[model samples]
Target: MQSFAKPRALEPLRPLAVHLPSMSYVDVKMRWKKDASFDAVPVLSRARDLRPLVSLARLLSPSPTPVSVVSKLRSSLETPDRRVTSFLRRFPAAFVESVGPEHNLPWFRLPDAAVHLLREERDVFAAGRADVTGRLRRLVLMCPRRRLPLRVAQGMLWHLGIPEDYFKDPDHDIAQDGFRILTSGDGVTCQDDDGRELGLIGDGKGKEMPLSVLQLNAMRKFGSVAKVPVPLFQSKGLRLKRKIQDWLEGFQRLPYVSPYEDFSHINPGSDVSDKRAVGVLHELLSLFVTCSAERRRLLCLRKHLGLPQKFHLVFERHPHVFYLLLKEKTCYVVLKEAYMAGGDTAIEEHPMLKVRKKYIELMEQSQEIIRCRRNRKPIELQSMVSCSGDIEDCTEILS
Candidate 1:
């Protein structure tokens, strides 16, 4: 039978004014090194309830003058190390319910057994450490096909005390395989391996970023409310991951904070085609092609700078946010319409936005290109505030 020692001895829970990461919630399972020569040793791991910690601790009780069998037990559990973390590792009820009926080894018994063996002596623990990868690999064979975020898997590793080197190690294929087995697909199309794959996938779009992560846990619905789904390509049943990667191909994302924006850089008093605007235009010119990721970043930057919200639809209903490229200057305003409207004028000749790098270079590099660029912008040549009736109302006096 297994049981946790008197947990009441631990300090009573008090409200901590400070915020702590969720990982800190789990118990710190530490095992003393088997080697007696070492003055003290502490092995930090998250796999707490799963290891043999409780069983071994019980054996190390102050009672020394017991039967020969109890002496053997003490010999097995005694450690040279006095320093230990002060947290009890307990199995979650959910895990307890899941495997209680099927395996006697479930509900952290295996983990406990492993910890007990570790404290038995140095050699035994060393052997188990070497076999850890193969054992984890076998566990992977039974992994669920559902794709989960690395965060959840990492959290599991920490809670389980799998070992820092195991999960941190790129060479440790077990943890990598475990990650793949656990979290393995687009948010939309995945079969949950176990019932525990909750709060893992992103907003059923591309890139498995948990929505809570997106809003920084400030609001529940910010990312979903703002998701502008874009058509990636003509491929069959577009993949969310591929689509997100394709979207990020063009633009870079700025931080979400408002202070990150520098509006002072804009020459507010100058002509529309001032240096700052020109610089923004040049950045637009530098883009090899239109992409959704960059478009999202453009919107985010605008919001960060307290600029107006801009979302452009590339296709029907597939809106992307971007700086309107119609003007030679990069408009602080976002284009809220489709880039290419399928019309006769949207032919191979007259275009809404100039896409040619050579032409933009000509405008930026020489006088001819500058003339072409200036002519292309309607606002540059056309008066935005023209009074139409006043022009026609002129009393005819010229013969």
Candidate 2:
């Protein structure tokens, strides 16, 4: 067994080197990066989590899709009627409305800037399709059946730079051998290597993918080894074995503070301590599921993370790094860079996303059944029998 040395003393907590109150948000963000802890979290956008934002953009992409049409489209994703209305009201600058072709119906269209944003997303995806295909193949390989749910899969399309319309085309086969659709009493699911049923997807119970050993430790390690006070400089000569040893040495150095250590002693009124707390919090968040944490949930951990009770202010002070989404009556703090557009894009495929896509696709089929129920009035017995047959045939195709 390898022997480990005792951990070194933790560095004394100090106020930020400079006052952030006088600095702009951008400057504060830039200065925060100078600290070794900047962006320690691996933030990634959850398209499903941000469905209201994404579905709205897609609904209004090409032209003014009718408000009714947009509602129907959003319904496929299980977006609530109130959420749709509220989302529109909250972001008035991104949307505008006009009369539909029928003259009485109102149609919604994205503003010029929003339209341009969609175009940029399209252009980026087109350029990166090959890159996405390779990553997607690897994702399927890791899963048991190479199958995933459509609900979860849809979110990843945006993250992987895959065209939203790609699946609509029967002829386009990027990973034909690795991906497919399955229909069951529950709903439509995607399969790769076709016959394998890995039991990765099921009722709400199986929705969460199994957590990896690496991910589980990422956040926990921060509180264990982040406060060493080695000279804040990189060594040019260190290589492989020595480099690993250096890392071990760094963690064991004097001035240690586990991210989990209590922060009640930190001077909350001082700008410096506040900044350090913010950086630590941000890094802690990176390890969270979905790269997001509910505001209330974070508040509950205030003592454990050494955060102030009014920790919400830290997000406001760094608008460029964090996005606060107020939806479903809960406030969610999302890392801005984890979303689609950023200096480092989400080109990497995620297993959790691959699994969820199937569920979303199943939801799509359920929505179709709902639409059929709502649209069908009284029909003759013979016609009703024929309609049921058609539904069965359609289900097979969707599967």
Candidate 3:
């Protein structure tokens, strides 16, 4: 695997000599730069990492026997760290541990209440498959590469409302052979003018499907990036706004520069060119930050947008427009205007938000189950569970 930066950084500065931490050897790297940020990067609390494990546990809950969680997780999880057992141990209430009868190794299984949440999740999935598929189809179409990594799809499962079983379902896989879709993993290439991979031909099973005129038009439009406008309200100085407008207008008059085009000839440090590059990045980020925050390091764009190692510095320079939260050792670059009063993202009451509310409910249900099992008394989770208020009143119904 290629080396990339971890979303979170090591905290309190652990010594490398005294003793190596168990989790330290894990592949926590993201597909982005590894350098420490100019600003302090925050470490994610243990709870944050545990959430992924919860989803993983649910995926594995159907097994009749307590299967070795590590062996099963290798395929399911992006990175099965050495700290897997340690992380699982942290959540005894959520997952039950036992020795595998056949393998004589430790195994984990979800409790009954957690399974109930899983059942509810399945119901939600059944109800939302059409919407999720539509969203996924649109996402695939929007991708400059026309294919996304399976790992990325899995990571966005909650927000996308994509079922965990999507890959298993031939109808749902984005790269179904009959659909003339090429999966990202396939070593196929479409040579652009600069010899960069730009388009997908199809699955290797049959004759290459040619791109339509409309599809070609879409590709052209995708390359045509818009300019970022300066915030007029924030600029108290009228002269400043006028200066920005003039600068932007002048910048627009220059020949359109495709990000994929070679920038090696251009001096990267030149203020005029650098300013243009910054605006390009801002415009690119605006497209994705429509729902929530995006990673400041932007690993996904590194190759696609031809960004440099220190590209994050651009967002850092424009602090007013981009708020960089050094959370989870990764910089979450959020648009300043996208946030509401309570720090929640402004997604306009999207269905994805509603799905996430169910996730919150799952966590609550799991906790309540643990509480009841331990205390031997009924544990009420009505107050703990949340609803997006789009469907129904969770408080009244649950109460």
Which candidate ranks first by lDDT, i.e. highest?
Answer: 3
Model 3 misplaced stretches (Cα beyond 4 Å) = 1-47, 62-64, 71-82, 97-107, 119-168, 173-180, 183-297, 306-309, 328-330, 341-349, 361-399
Show where candidate 1 strays beyond 4 Å: 1-126, 129-131, 146-148, 158-161, 170-399
Which tens-of-lDDT digit does each residue in 315-373 have in candidate 3?
Answer: 65454445555545545665443332223322223344443544445544555666666
Per-residue error (Å), model 2, residue 104: 5.3
lDDT string, candidate 2, 1-399, tens digits: 876988899997778966454312221221122221222321322233345555577767547767775565555555544556545544433556667778677667775545554555555555654555544433333333444445444444544446556666675554442455455533544342343222222322333332222223333444332343211122223233454445335333423233433345555565545555555554444443355656665553454345667777777555445656654465667654445334333223333342233223323433454454467732221111121112122212211
Model 3 vs. true fold: TM? 0.50
Decide which is better by lDDT, 1 or 2. Answer: 2
Q: Give the clash count for each candidate.
A: 24, 27, 6
Please provide TM-scores, in order, for all candidate models, with all chains considered together.
0.16, 0.37, 0.50
| Backbone clash pairs in model 2 (N, Cα, C under 3 Å; residues 3+ apart or in different chains), count | 27
Position 208, candidate 1: lDDT: 38
User: What's the lDDT for all of these models?
Assistant: 0.27, 0.45, 0.45
Residues 1-399, candidate 1: write the lDDT tens digits: 878776666686767745443212111122211222111111111111222333333333332212223234433333222212111112211011123334442222222222323334233323454333322222222123223334334433322224434545576554333333333343343334343332222212353322211232224323342432211222223333454554334222211221112345433432211222222322221221221112333432332222322212221122122222212222222222123322311112211112121112212222332344457731122111112211122221111
Full candidate order by lDDT, most accurate first:
3, 2, 1
Residue 148's lDDT in candidate 1 = 32
lDDT at residue 235 of model 2 (Cα atoms): 20
